[model samples]
Target: MVAGERLKDRYAVDHLPLSHQGMGEVWPARDTVLDRQVIVKLTASSVMDAALAKRFRREARLTARLAHPGVPAVYDFGQHKGRFYMVMQRIEGIDLADLIAEHDPLPVSWVAAIGAQISSVLIAARQIRLVHRDIKPSNAMLERSGAVKVLDFGLAAIHGDDRYSRITQSGDSLGTVGYMAPEQIEGSPTDHRTDLYGLGATLFDLLTGRPPFDGPTPTATVWHQLQTSPPRPAALRPEVPAVIDDLVHALMARHPQDRPPSAAAVYEVLAPLARNLPPIPGVVSDQPDAIRAYAAMVGQVPLPAHHETRDSTTAEYDDPDLATRQAEARAQQLATTGNPRAAARQWRELADRRASQFGEQDAAVADYRLRAIRLHAEIGEHSRALRQLHSLLQDRIAVDGAGHPTVQAIQDEIAKLTQGGLDRSER
Candidate 1:
């Protein structure tokens, strides 16, 4: 390959590859037809068997389906000289792995910001029933505008599509050794939670300057993932927030059931810490970003008017009890559908309505409020959870006395939250 040599009469690739691995080689190229910079990934001729070729095409098509700012756009896929090639947007940035190598132990806010961005992309991927089986730091790029782009969907898997071709055989372990989830290493079927585990491992490395589990051999690392519990991130870096430490631990849980229900839930927890990030000295440019310009324009959009008037007939027919029941039902549905944040909002509204209609001391109102508290805690809103728990404790103690088990349990939860620990008690 040379700078003037064209592939498929469109992509003119350089003489040397930007990077190469056992699977394929990536070259920074210029798309002569489109007159834009692009990346061409070509599978090694030796590995361009039927299975690999099918997987390469699948990756290109599936990744193209994902329309997210955090994901690179797939341009084209084809065969060139008997080797499969995929054309993608040439992202200009340093991958997280290289960034970490240059500046280890990243700032807390930057780490949180990068994790949240990746989680946002995962949320999008999850909506389309796509699971990125490999999510190591090397696959996460940090652009000059401070935007994160999740790369490499070569190991992606579609949910409920066992008939589709898979690059790996059944019972065969895949993914980087340090970031593999316990179930993945055990050759068990995986889902979106597996990606969360990988993100946790990546975040751990970002915070502590090393992965949570590393051993002399891959087998030993697998054993560590299956049998060992990593020390909290805060243990290695005292500046790390306790909430982030807890979130990382939850994401890396050995049991899938122990992790957050979805990537959206993880994003909700990380959003607060991701604010007020300090820019990277070199990686983030000082020039105006296109995204910022678009955001500025969007901020000027007009808001819709809120109507204050309600028809008398509609008001007369509206039953408060029925409305409360309906709200509770909606909240339950949202909770069951892997949307804890929306469910918490519904529960909060129900609780407020109940308190306004009846007294705060009412049993139904207390139940709704307790549900909201638990839901908030589930999403790692410890401060809000603690506030609600303390309020509930006061109400329960006033009615059932200080020694009551319910009041005691609430008190215990308050203690745990105050101490920046997770409440493991049954909801």
Candidate 2:
């Protein structure tokens, strides 16, 4: 929240903030261990209800699942002083919104390239059954290498994952009015093709320097998207190829079933046109980008067979139950065995991993960390036990406030740990 302040005692806040959006503020930061620049996004406030916290946790899991060059990497999800924070790779690029403004009606090739790049990301998302509900221009970044990085998974959802936390009230759905699909605007169930409609609107903007359907007010804009036929980009910008025009209309079809079957199918059409992109003067840098070269080689690899999962929530994340359950179960078994230190280490690792997911303020994190301290104390590592106890106490106080019951409980635990003892539950 302030310059020079640190989150998790690892990420040092480098500046005030890069920008502020609807959910919270985005700050520029540095990862001390990796020695790399990162961006930290925080919630508007530390106080969030159960639903909001669930949504925040789901967003972190959702974005982390979308591992791709086109998506910014998520580093850590945490909390400090009750504020939930998401640490992500800091992508340097001009927003597509700004790019469109500076060079309205971008060259036909660039339009194809941008649309193709966006479609490529959507293709990746569709593979995992993830729907990026919001796919407008501002949510995309045109990198120096001329590649587009799809940004903001805040509105993303996985298909068949009906347990998603509601980000809005009962009737209100969150989305950009001009770009939302008819079903999305109507609060009807949405899927991958929903994102295709948004892509159509984005490409329409890139081609004609305006949204496909516009009106004087947001209400009117919603009506246009819901009722009016998608405008032909070629009619507004004669230079737009008719092939591209037909593709855009297909993507923005009123019925989801009528849109392009898949984002990959859409990409197949746009990729050929994306060739030989001439760089824009100020928008794209002349510097050689290693990622671009690496991507060229990656393109040659054969695509995996498309998977259509019905019950899965995340795309293709490694089995956490296999990873977490086995480790914790083994740790529990190891607790009564000859090696106490190894068990302690296992508990500590679980604590750290969960801390990365839920933050240090989490009760489960405190529980496992306390287990580690208890084992350390049992093994006569008194100093280490005391240190961890004190650290947990500090975090509890920060998150729960000084006078809260949990803080008081943590204070008592620290006192007991210093005295070479722990509660029966901790033991």
Candidate 1 worst ten-residue window by lDDT = 308-317
Colliding pairs, model 1: none
For model 1 the local lDDT of residue 376 reads: 90
The TM-score obtained by model 1 is 0.69
Tens-digit lDDT string for candidate 1 (1-427): 5566789988999778999867689998999988999999998897667777777787787788778989999989888889989999989999999988988879999899899989989877765557788999999999888889999887788665552326653333478898978877777888878999999999998998888888899888888888888557988899899899999989998898898777777877787897777768899887889985885587488755752212221232233245667788999999999999899889878877665433365567767777888889888887788877987888888987889777777777777676666334433
Please estimate how well model 2 matches the true structure, expressed as its whole-model Cα lDDT.
0.81
Candidate 1 residue runs with Cα over 4 Å from true position = 163-165, 168-173, 295-427
**Superposed Cα RMSD, model 2:** 8.9
lDDT of 2 by residue, 256-305 (tens): 98997777777777888987788798888778878788888988987546
Candidate that scores best on TM-score: 2
Total clashing pairs for each candidate: 0, 0
In angstroms, the error of model 2 at 331 is 30
